[model samples]
Target: MVGDYQTLKNIIEQSLLTALFQPIYDTEQAQLYGYEALIRGPSNSPLHSPIALFDSAVEHGLLSELELICRQVSIETFAKLGLQGKLFLNVSPMVFLQDDHPKGATLSFLEQYGVAPEKVVIELSERYVVNDPELLAQALLYYRELGFKVAIDDLGSGYAGLKLWSEILPDFVKVDRHFISNIDKDSVKREFVKSILALGANINSKVILEGIETEQEFYQLQELGASLGQGYLLGRPELLPVKILPSVLTTHQRKVKYGNYLDKLASSVFQHAVSFDSQTKTGAIVDYFTQHKHLHSLPIVRDQIPVGMALREEVLELFASPYGRALHEKKPIIDMLSSQPVVVEADTKLDEVAKLVTSVHDEQLLWHFIITEQGRYIGIGSVRDLLKQLTEQQLQQASYANPLTQLPGNVPIYQKIDDLLTKQQAFHFAYFDLNNFKPFNDVYGYAKGDSVIRVLADILQSYCTAEDFIGHIGGDDFIAIFVSDNWQQKADSICQHFDQAIRSYYTQEDLNQGGIVSPSRSGELQKYPILSVAVAVVEPDVERCRSHHDIAELASSAKKEAKKRCKELGKSAVYLCQRRGPDGL
Candidate 1:
């Protein structure tokens, strides 16, 4: 603290902090969503990292002063550069929102640069503990009323931010980088993103993911319905960032690509239905149900908001007893409404709907759920419809799966690689071939050949994580497209494991010689080594590669090279191609 004190003091006193803009992309729309203003101290100073600089500010009781300078510098530079799209200004709630802090400073600063309040997003940083929810909320509401939008920065960074989110419900949610970094390879992170996206959808808050430094991360975020992304892959922080969208990364429009109905949104099965206002008389609803016997249940609304669903059976039973009509004829329909109804937004994914339907204790509500748009009832859907679509989707996917190993076959494998290419994701393509499989099959018989294939399948499956695609390309050939960077180590591990595992398939006599005898094409007996797997790994420069066809051709060449390398190495080995793209070198 002694050595760093004067440097931090000098930076604060001199107002040496400058702002750099990092582009936040609208992944779905293929447009520039906005720039998150990142702050930096003097490059030569030890406080160059914003974390250290701000932490030093807090230690020196200059947090409020430092934040003010950062805000002013960020807002003014954003306007001076004429950077279009929203300007996200990160604010420490503890320092900036304190009651005694300068109230008109933001407006005055924006006015100096001629930047509109509407174009600025007041981002609340979640690094500080928010002891006063009311004060923090009042500050956000103040910004909202001042013609500025608000965003919760670093959501999931801590429990405080989570509570702040529920209380504030800002226009944007920038999820913490912790979950976004390796989401493609981590199922837990993927689930976390799924839940956050679902939460944002229900509340109509746009979800933004930060720290998407890889194409795999971006594709994973988009596939999970993330609306905004920010990281070095999109753009690094610059004094003046490029205004145009990155052509290669943002070229493809987001498509609804799913292997099955599990990923489909709930709106796919939407049907128009009538809803009753809560004030409507019970007798009137009963009369309407009687006239329309086909309608089993209907949603109840209050002032254009769905309150609950009303079942026809419950309403009819309420009136069937003697004197029941006189007892409840004039009562408002809200009284007999189901205590809790299954309600979903129009854009909620079908897979999510299925989870809610299956977990529910209410038998009727489980099947019949209300679908709403912006909290107003639009239609109703039944479980029967959801199940039918799911069944059809499963059967379709099953048809494409290989009957032998139950792994996805050629069609799905091709589609997977093509989709990654279309999304501009760079990945490793590993082609696997059983080196002596046919000879082993010839000598050991077909059943043993099948077991050998299954053994290879099991080995491949072991390497399958959330980020890699493993597919059976038929016969003795298979493929693995790895999104993670550690595929090289995995490729080595696969070869080494296969080298040892294949020996188990050889009979004692064959194992003794470490070879099998089979007839050659000309009918001469030939000796073949025990079955060994050969892997060819290709890292295509995605910019030059167009489709999976190009990848398949490259992989084929790599496979041939791997076979050559296997003969030279006298064991199973991975051949990594030095050449990239369709035409090697």
Candidate 2:
């Protein structure tokens, strides 16, 4: 107690804080996403422990000051070391709750280091409970509005983290080491990981698994289809972090996005085109259009800014008319500019560009649109090209979609898994089979069973985020590739929802008795348990599972295990397998 006060005082007064960076690997993309800025006190000091340091700062009534200095050190070090990707800075919510919390200090620090606000992620940990969630949310929202990204750190470490995630909708969710440790040998831990992935997928948050230390744990997460990971296995925290992940983490698989893909946009179809400076003569613009013959309009640029568009036909007709050539040949083409043309950012997706193109009330302006990169004129695109691309995408999707559930069919499901495996990505592939489904079909007829299958499909689809892929693999069997970190919880949620929903299908008497009287395989009467989904989850390994076919076999074995568990429990059950493909890779 005697030494604590002097230590804290010296720590703040001497500016003894420093930062170490830990790389976060994006397994899906097989690239380094960024580094997390971990703050540390002097190595030999008792305050060296980050928790102890921050706790002491809070105890001594200097948390805000300590946090401000920490941010400055992290930003400065990150810049000085020439780090690539984002820099995640931890900030306690209580710091923001302070009356003089040094507003804009982080941004100012960022500016001083020449770090763009968008490249930094402000991480809020759930370890410290907030007295006011609304105020914390507002504070995080303010950072977001200021161009900095927000993340909920230490997710699953406490109950408040989930609630905080729902409120903030942060860009990333960092799972605690407790969940990632020994997950390979622990089925329950694996299930927890699946649940977290599932939740992250549904809410569109990138989940980073922290504290991964062993080869088994690393491979375990990769199998779970984890998107981002940070720990000793990937790369340990150091004063200087590596820009690229180790070769062991690198893969040669093709990047695949089936139903969830939206990379194509207005920029995809934008044509690099010639532009006329606003001061160019009208006659010269007409002459240039005649030389090209195919160009409909020429973008008018003034000082790298798109001001308007000069129509080829409008300019030509005026000059071609009687005495028209002599009347306007020498004047600037600014007069020939049509009403402000449809201008769109190059990266705007097809659907949005479609709306902007169609929403134009004027018929002339609808013909072409200007595409800009960072507000500077880059190229032009025609509505016809945008529509053509949109139509092709829709048709392609429809061709691969199943007729019954309207979900991706066997081709897409296979392709999705094949791509993931080929790219050396880790993803848990769950094969779903309806328990006692055949017997139920025998008793209730085929059509009712089809309805039951559709209901199951809806349940899976409801939980699927854009990152998750759900497909119909023929009839009672379906596949869902969990790209979320919280898939275990989601898998449990899936079982919960399916169990409750299936009860509605059974007649009251049979449901009361707990199942229908169905024909057995031996043609004898059998009292089967209530209808439920038996889900078998497996994280595919690139070395063992060469293709989706190998995954199918692994999942088949897992399904048998799940069926056994379901029989004992008399309800939906999930079985996660960590077996090598067939005999071994």
Candidate 3:
């Protein structure tokens, strides 16, 4: 074979290797999550494929060298591309433990490229069994200490198996592609993936399905609630960073729409119940329940911590018998209390709470759940109230979500902004819209036009922090509230990614032409360029923009300026409104 030891050595010395990037998508967020850097030998060479290239290196005793080169080149190329999101770089366990391996070189390259360690996931293939598990574990700990995330690759098909998974407890586990192929029709594969997902959830690890090549596989994975995915169907390895496709975006939006209808529980729905000290006599509770007939349940607390609950029916039943009141009235209320009620944290989901309540076969279902903050009783939630709130939320989500993207509509957006303002919190409100979107709609028809909107929505949702809020203001208009200080960076990233992704929507001829011919309002033909996003950022002064209307007005002004700037510069742009001083606007 031409790819022998000598040829491999020559290739490494000449630096004939290059890197290709394939994107990984977060199905839940429907955004471009990150790219995995794949190494390749020179084109038209016998070592073009990675298998041949790496096998040769292993035979030549230069595997460590080749891996180092791959990493360095991958980092350099990724940085040069100015790609957003994480970079998944593969590392062989054997190569990783070599004495001559470049341990510090990775961190050095990242520093040189200004790439954060947090943005790189060190992917270790489970196929290579580690000779020194302790050393590898130490090395992995070092990587984690430096803020690098670790992922186990080819999990099910490898020798490492559960032993390695248990020992490492990696941040991510990549399911082997064999299970992902034709997964929609393979019940065995689907169940395996589901089990993996459950295991991942239990360990707080993210499961990334690899080598996805079909729409059915992707949809099935999504249906199984797999979050991270990478495969040819999502994107093929390319010299440059890959953008998420419109179809993926649309699928994500559909999933989100369905998820919105799922029941959600909010602690606010629980009513504030009167609580009595555990030391109080039964007579006091009897008198309170007698006086307040509307109270159904009462929390019995000790040092502000709920010890148990007293249901109205149980307490009233005791007083019904002539001798029962005299027999137990002098006893402490704690003695008469029912078995400790179900205690749920303020943020527990209703479905989970329902499960907990129903787990007991007895009459506990009728008991009110004690809601607590930091283990201290705050309120009580009845089954009726929980059911009602869940139904209301479902109805509200159905009505309040945008039909196209299924994002929260304008009403919720306004309410969120108003809530932040009421709390006197600082937030950056951004308005996003597509440049030359109408012409795109006219040329591409409604289906394709909706795809563009969904992409934008996905981008916003993906880039935003959990604390941030995203809402569709209808059609091409959208709003995002950024509570993080890095709002400008996020806005710029959204614009940049949108610009890169929008090109895929157009034909090669149209892209080469830089614009398309479409009819104007007067029935005359005009050239309209491909779609670009314009973002308007406004960091409202708390005192000045006291209402959602005030913030919207300022954002609208900034949006106009941003659109104007885009037109002038002939590209996407983000314009921030000048901030007001602390004194006043």
Candidate 4:
């Protein structure tokens, strides 16, 4: 056998590598999407597989060199071939900050091959242990400034995987193959995928489901809000002659992406036309409005406050209508126009707009809807124009929506949790369980069980106010959100209502017996206690929540404590679990 040193050097140098292109489809469009550049060495070569090659390289102190070669080749070849769409290239964190990186040369090569900086995605692999998080973060920042869109590869693969995400803030997150491989066979894996996907959304990161080899996985990932797909099912990688894959857009997804685009524009609504003081004359308003053709209307503000609106039509109508004849004499534009056309929050849903557009009530005759935050008019978005944008966003959301409850589901729930934690908002999170739901479902048919769940959801909805958030955690599990002050009260109310509504689904005999009278999984008669619930509440630390994996471990621990307490007390109607944090807290 060859000696370790020589063998390692040879493996690194002679890693006969080939490329495999896994398609990353548009989350909303369902098109062939783009491709993630994956590398595989010769079947017999020591450096044949990424795992083997990288492991051996690390052991031999050649990891940096091996990673460098891979980068050079992937960039050089893809840029030369003028590949369309995006190129996802995996880079090790250790190699990302190499002192002598050939970035200048790579950029020059890309220019020569007609590939722009935006077209290339640098996916930092989840392989090496990061010794200095600050160093990694700085490197990522530098690369992003240089026009390289960053990604974290194999997210949720190890202890350090989630940590890297906080440090790097990747543009894309590639879900590990292990989680994607058999999601159809395991509920646990599906939850894991949902959590990871949600984490990605919270960070505003795109997600690419890796190692998806079956149609089932593809559809499942789509349903989980994963817009990009990178796996064998779409198409395997090929050298040279790049063949374009077929479109993957579904009817529903196409509509949704359009909506999201609108929402994005709405976020920057403040950048549009300026609002005129309510005192401004019609002549002054017309001058400002004409200066910017993009402006559909002029907001009427009084004392730095927007309370009314003046539109192009309203101005023209002022000139034509009987009311206009009187204004024609002498009056300010504020006097001629109506009060601010019914304003809506910038974050309002497109569906809400759809309904408002068709409303016949005192719908405030208006040219546009003014979007505001905290009672301040920030931007004005036309209902007609934003409709298209809402369609697109919905498509993407639909891709990740859970089929069971039609709610945003587990993926969205994870995303919301991550967002709340990251924002460092002081809030309480309650993990809800249906207490003996399985036995109830088992005793009654799935249909009746579903009805009970729907009822539970209805009750939760009744209690959820604008500040409150609720999510379905899938299969007898639920989640509730509230600010610090009213969190416990909301949770108590939910439990009280849930206990009542859930019991109503049971038969008189079952309720009287105070236990489940049903066959077990093995068809044996079993009498388990009446259904009960346990909740685990916690205030998360944004910086430490890290990835879905970390947050989940915290939630899981809380849940276990709840379960243990329930068993110990021999009670089940409702129990408050422990609150966990650092030792001092």
Q: Could you tell which candidate, 2 or 3, scores higher by TM-score? A: 3
Q: Which ranking of candidates, highest TM-score first?
A: 3, 2, 1, 4
What are the lDDT figures for the candidates, one per model? 0.82, 0.83, 0.82, 0.66
**1-585 per-residue lDDT for model 2 (tens digits):** 313877888888888988999898776665678999988899999899798998888788878888888898999999999888889999888887788877888888888989999999999987777788889889999999999999988888765887888888888889999999999999999999899899889989888899988878877887788878888877888986654345345321112334344337788888889887999998898789889998888899998789998877788888777999899988999876758888889878888998888888878777789999899999999888998999887776544766666667777777888998888888888889998898889888999999998788767754555578787777788888987788898788889989988888889999889888876878888898889889999877776678888988998888999999999888999999878576653
Candidate 2 vs candidate 4: the TM-score winner is: 2
Q: What's model 4's TM-score?
A: 0.40
List runs of model 4 lying over 4 Å from the truth: 1-16, 42-44, 96-105, 108-112, 240-585
Task: Count clashes in each candidate, considering only residues at least 3 apart in sequence or on different chains.
Answer: 0, 20, 0, 36
Superposed Cα deviation of residue 490, candidate 1 (Å): 46
Q: What local lDDT score does residue 265 receive in model 4, on the 0 to 100 scale?
A: 39
Residue 175 shift from truth in candidate 3, angstroms: 3.4
Tens-digit lDDT string for candidate 1 (27-103): 66566778989999999888888988888877877788888889988987888888888999999888744556788
Q: Write the per-residue lDDT of candidate 3 for residues 1-585, one digit (tens) a residue.
A: 537777788878888889999998877666778999999998888999998898777777888989888888999999999898899999878886677876688999999988999999998886666767777777888888989999888988877656767898999899999999999999999999999999999999889999999888888998898888989878889996545444665446545644544446648567877789999999889899899987778889999998988877888788898798889888998988757688888888887887777775548436678888888888888878777776776667645688777777867777788898888898888899888889999998999999999888877765775578788888898888999899989888888888887899999999999989999999999999778888888888876676887887788778899999889888889898885423335
lDDT of 4 by residue, 252-361 (tens): 33234222322353543334657887666676666565677666677777765578777775576565666754566356666776443767666666667656655624
TM-score on alpha carbons, each prediction: 0.45, 0.47, 0.62, 0.40
